[model samples]
Target: MLKTILSISGKPGLYRLLSSGKNTLIVESLQTKKRIPVLPKDRVVSLGDISMFTDGEDIALSEVLTRLHEKQAGVAVSEELLKDSDALRNSFGEVIPNFDRERVYTSDIKKLYTWYNILIEAGITDFADQDEAE
Candidate 1:
């Protein structure tokens, strides 16, 4: 689930939380399956904790991803779309029509697609929490 998938700042890719110690947390890279110790000083954010700005209220990243999954039928976003800002925005708008245009930058859209691709490549298609799925 998204809760166990972490995005550590300054790191290249997503990491899966493995264990915790008194001083550091153990994480395995989702991309390479390499384990690393994350210090307390490192900014670690779980994907479940992320949200996107919207007109009414913020939408959870997991929900956004789920919507995207449904919209694309699990197909990964095209590389050409990723590079073109207009195309990226158009694609994202189709998935999340009300995502705050002012707050969600082009970089954020690209990252969303990138993360979605990574998760898909890792065989993680379920973005909903277990409780929510039930």
Candidate 2:
């Protein structure tokens, strides 16, 4: 499941973008000039490479997830069968808090595969602005 999620949402701006160890989340704003800090569980517009090179450190999606957890903000994995842009636009939703195996088991496996492939097929791959912390 994790592999599938990464494979599809791997493209920028289509999921709850997370870094490896940061304390902030990079929520894309359509009306602002900066990526803001959101609760870990906050659904986000993850359509680009949200990584940042601050001073010298590289901030990647993995780091964002770490930070989200530290902030104690809830994050939900959206399985919504939406268009690429639509998926990015409404990325913010209820966070799941924790992804226990039992919780995932509740969903139908076939459905999961469908959503995963859809993203992989239609997700974007350009505009990964590295080092956004400039």
Candidate 3:
């Protein structure tokens, strides 16, 4: 589920939590399908725990992704189009109208799109499954 998926800072792709060690967590890269150990010092966050700042309040990543999924009719958005910050912001704005422009950068937007595509390719589209897993 979404909770098991993580986005590590400075990492190029998403990882799936596999197991926990004494001071590290084993994770499998969604892109490479290779497993690696994440040290305690590494900046890691569960997709389920991530939220974006909005004008009124924080919006969960799940909500934003769900809205995007609905908007695109469950299909992945074009990666090429998402490369442009202006386009990314416009697309994201449609999903979360009040998302904080100052806090969310182009890199963040790209990461969200990349992660969403990875999730979709891995057949992790069941939002209900994510909720039940929590």
Candidate lDDT (C-alpha), each: 0.94, 0.34, 0.83
User: What are the per-residue Cα lDDT tens digits for candidate 3 across 17-82?
Assistant: 999989999999987899999998899998888888898889788787888788878888897767
lDDT of 2 by residue, 1-134 (tens): 12112222223323333343355544432322234446546543332433433334544543434343333233323445333533432221212223332333323222333433344444322222344433
Off by over 4 Å in 3: 128-134
Q: Give the TM-score of each candidate.
A: 0.96, 0.22, 0.87
Residues 44-126 of candidate 1 have per-residue lDDT tens digits of 99999999999879999999999999998999888988999999999999999998999999999999999999899889999
| Candidate 1 residue pairs that clash | none
Best candidate according to TM-score: 1
Model 1 accuracy (lDDT, Cα): 0.94
Say which prediction, candidate 1 or candidate 3, comes out ahead on lDDT.
1
Ranking of predictions according to TM-score: 1, 3, 2
How do these models rank on lDDT, best leading?
1, 3, 2
Q: Is candidate 2 or candidate 3 better by TM-score?
A: 3
The TM-score measured for candidate 3 stands at 0.87
Q: Pick out the ten consecutive residues of candidate 2 with the lowest summed lDDT.
A: 1-10
